[model samples]
Target: MTAEIKKQKHVGRWVAVGIVGVIVLALLAAIGWYFVRVNPSVQQVETIETAFPEESLRPEAGEGDGQPVNVLLLGTDARGEGDSLLTDLGDRADTILVAHIPPDRESVQIMSIMRDSWVEIPGHGMAKVNSALAYGGVPLMVQVVEGIIDQRIDHVSIIDFAGFEGLTESMGGVTVNNDIAFSYHGYDYPQGEITIQGEEALIYVRARSPFSDGDYQRVHNQRAFLRGLMTQLMTRENLTNPNRMADILATISPHVATSDTFDLGTVASLGSQLAGIGNSNIQTFTMPTLGTGMEGSQSVVHVNWDGVEEIRAAFDEESMTTFEPPAER
Candidate 1:
């Protein structure tokens, strides 16, 4: 029954073992190759400027990883005509978004604040919310936002047009649903689905003059663009390809400036924590407002105090699941 049969069985087992070992080695090699290609570009993230507001002025943040985190993201136009972002920290920001991550990190929420919202800016008196940046740089901006939300912001970032271009280009462009067709800056943007990259991306987001609703429609467009951008970044194509991700981060890093504590490692960890999130997990909306009204000679957006209180409750509860932004007007 026999010696030959036993010898053949042993040979088969050895061959199977060899095949599994080879497969494991090949998988490890592939992972190492991917890491080598993308890691250098990730290091570029560390190069972005870090400008944190003074701790004395910042609202108190809850300690430990179990608490929620709020990050203030500002997009400025201070880099025009040979100017630089660092030299013009007091420039009025056109884009103001508060990015919130709940304790579980199951999803990301981006809330766009109207630029001309009439809000109390500490020592500056009642003025446009955007003026907080222009009146007192990052510190006052932080204070004003914290006052509005009544919650501590764990981090902040300021990006200019260059950064916007890099983000769109790095993703090879992003597609957003254009609700209104409008010609802007010599470029005609048709209504419907469109993909824009580089400078066109910035122009697309910045074009609000063509709309009747003005900043109201502009904020909606901004949220749409951001939703599209994040969806592209989270795609399997970019996430699985180290070279693609490297190219993206390399382009974006130079133009972005974040708070000191929110470095590349912290960002990467956030990415990891939210690795499985898909398009449905991301939320982008504008903060509720009472439409635009005149406050003396200047026009400004009126704050919906009731909605603000609702948001504060959501923040304290660490869940935006029930949060509802006001209908677009």
Candidate 2:
């Protein structure tokens, strides 16, 4: 009986040690997750707000409640020695777009504003929309766009052309529906259904020399690329898989510069709502332009206000419904 009791005590001690070990390991794992995942996400949101101050213009929390939010997305090609970001003194706004996420978060409306189109720059006089940024950075760009559309913008996310590779590669390349057959940079892109790799998508939209519409067709191709990108990101398979998430995060991390107002928690919640939305629910259009002209040495395109106002009305129904001042020469 004494020997049996000793064996039982030894076994009990070992079992207690194993239980403590398991608990310690679990505690360590939770701490690791909090630091590696949750903390960085929170930091990302705070960093975004610090980057752009325009986020304050968003309707107050209760005012719009769950209404749609507007984001100004800039895809800049000004990547040189000192002009990598718009922070560079001479950088121009290459791509200007307004993305609207509705209250339900179920749908999104993306309106692309042509960079070269001429419009009134608030502090400065009339000039090409792209020139607004070169004049006064994000502030001037926001002022001009808001003045033209008569709507308050929520936030801004600026990404480089190089970032395109990350996005295309994240989804293992996106499939774009080409309207016509074309060749550029020694690569032939056929019409109908086609899959494009990271490098291919870059050259596909960057091809402006061969197209008849020139910049006009380039804008159209951009719209097509965005459509494909959104479709791929929101798919059911991509959202739930860890491998896809890692690729997406890797692709988005280095290339994206967003306004400080974006909350990661909000984005996490919004992602689920966005999954239900489709391309059909979203609207995409470009600002009207009158070819190109020379403002002394700069080649710029004049804005066609009539067409722009028509599209603006759809977003800001309260004011932009009609063009009161009308277009001028």
Candidate 3:
């Protein structure tokens, strides 16, 4: 975050925050709709429970860095949803992702760090990266992810899956391309394009048991959902109706936790900056891993340190636009 006001760029794509960006992008692209008046009682953004990692542990950069900036986004499985999670010590972040916006602001790159990927926690020994949330709330989650990328996280936010229920309902539904046919939560998702809304929408993104590849496919589904959501928001139906768009965005506020510095004004500006980034400009991939194995009595994903170095180099050079993710394991 910037030293002056800690204004980290809003992630152009995130399950929770990502959807919000599309909302902003759609609004910004529409006439007289970019300026959203957030109801104080229903603001979708909130300050995290814990402060960021100690300054010493964070990389020195700010809003002025002109360097690529990173935002950490956590998606939970429902335990201690939203701000309540600040005090819910047992809650673990189920989805861990880093959204990188290059200095040019011409494109966005989303890197998903598997929650099960074994990594070093600040004060704890190696363990599932998600465990960092359980150990020290948002602060530790930010610390662990930063350590992996070797960069300071300018801002952090989280959202619970439950929030998507209302969020999806507000949009009528979102459509995504399904690669595998699967029945989940009593709903049959065919191997083709389908529209999902309400409870089924949540079921679609959270269904991993239906895939042999498990979370691997689930993360892919998450990105697909975001892709569809962006299309829905950009539809003339939503962009033309300011009231409808405002209410749809509000449905997610109670379920998201972001830094207090993440205000609507800043969000609008970033939205304006990223207004031109279409789905093609927003790329998604997972951190490289050798494979999964027993890291004791527990199964864990092993990080590909060599691949990580390549990723670090890509970030350093602001060449992520041309970077290719490692082949899936």
Candidate 4:
């Protein structure tokens, strides 16, 4: 081959390879954006104003604000119409948890409140705490929780059951230590470590009939399952793999709705702050309550007034690491 002809062929081959590389990079960028971009279903509320608003009691605002960040996590069974947003009306909150991330951001503490706990919902007479969601939506739920803990909630996330299943499956199922074996919906979950996904995971979190304590034991299981799930998700392999992370995010976003005050940037910032925390650093506790009793005709959990104060003090002082339950006290 002539030198000039060979040189021209070589130039053509290099141009073709460059075009292919650009195409591949563009495709990857598009996939990343699809997964990383915030979903519209995560509706932000302008302000999460509670019924009893005391400016003095609210946590300070600014970078390094020297106060623990509180997020109210609501797990609802409200299956809205297909593609419809979760509404406040006629829907009940099945799970209520307050996730506290201290200013140091070294750990996260989760306190689960029994849905059937009898409490005074602001503007409404004494009723089941979960009823607040049906009565006043996110605002009422926040108001009631704030009243109980005496802490300002910085953000709110409402997750449906579908999202829970999707998130668990996206992580290839989560393995939680099953302290007690139980059967639910014809599926037998033996004691010891168990890995569950999809419908089985839903059954695992929702089971309550087998235990004498009913919902109380179920809450404990939920916390164990959550800890296991977080441990799996925080692994370097999962976080660094864009495709895995995107699949997880896409599965979760549509099924979640956040307060208007919380945005994509806020979510990313919080994730960054909490990146160092591990499952061991995440402490989970059930809100202190006297055993279940009948209120009129319906069964409910009575709040232990003294124990409640101790729990509130721990949150107020940002000392949950050392905080003990009423039983321990």
Best candidate (score: TM-score): 1
- Candidate 3 regions off by >4 Å? 1-36, 41-44, 62-65, 78-83, 89-91, 231-242
Candidate 3, lDDT over the whole model: 0.74
Query: How far does residue 298 in candidate 3 sit from its true spot (Å)?
Result: 0.4
1-329 in candidate 3: lDDT tens per residue?
56544333333223568778789887666644334344542454566755588888887665554677688877775544344745563445667788887777767777888878999887889999888877887788888888888887876777777777778888788888888999987899999999999889888888889888888898888877876776566445655455776787678887777876556655545656666456676777789888888977998889999998887877776545666666667
lDDT of 3 at 75: 75
- Which lDDT values do the candidates have, in the order given? 0.78, 0.67, 0.74, 0.76
Worst 10 residues of 3 by lDDT: 5-14
At residue 241, what lDDT does model 3 achieve? 59
Q: Candidate 1 lDDT, tens digit per residue, 103-193?
A: 8777788889998889998887899998877777777788888888888877888787888888888777899988888998888789899
Evaluation by lDDT, superior candidate among 2 and 4: 4
Model 4 ranges with Cα > 4 A deviation = 1-64, 88-91, 325-329
Better of 1 and 4 by lDDT: 1
lDDT of 4 at 87: 43
Q: Roughly what TM-score does model 2 have, to 2 decimal places?
A: 0.76
**Total residue pair clashes for candidate 1:** 0
* Candidate 4 lDDT over residue span 1-329, tens digit each: 99999999999999999999999999998756754453432332223344323455444444556778888987777756654345442446677888887767767778889999899987789999988877877667777888888778878877778889988888888999998999989788999999999989989989999998889889988888888887787666765565676667778877777766567667656776666467778888788888889989999999887888877777766445554445511
Residue pairs in candidate 3 whose N, alpha carbon or C atoms collide under 3 angstroms: 1-154, 14-18, 44-253
**What's the best-to-worst order under lDDT?**
1, 4, 3, 2
Model 1 TM-score on a 0 to 1 scale: 0.82
Instruction: In angstroms, give how far residue 134 of model 3 lies from its true place.
Output: 1.5
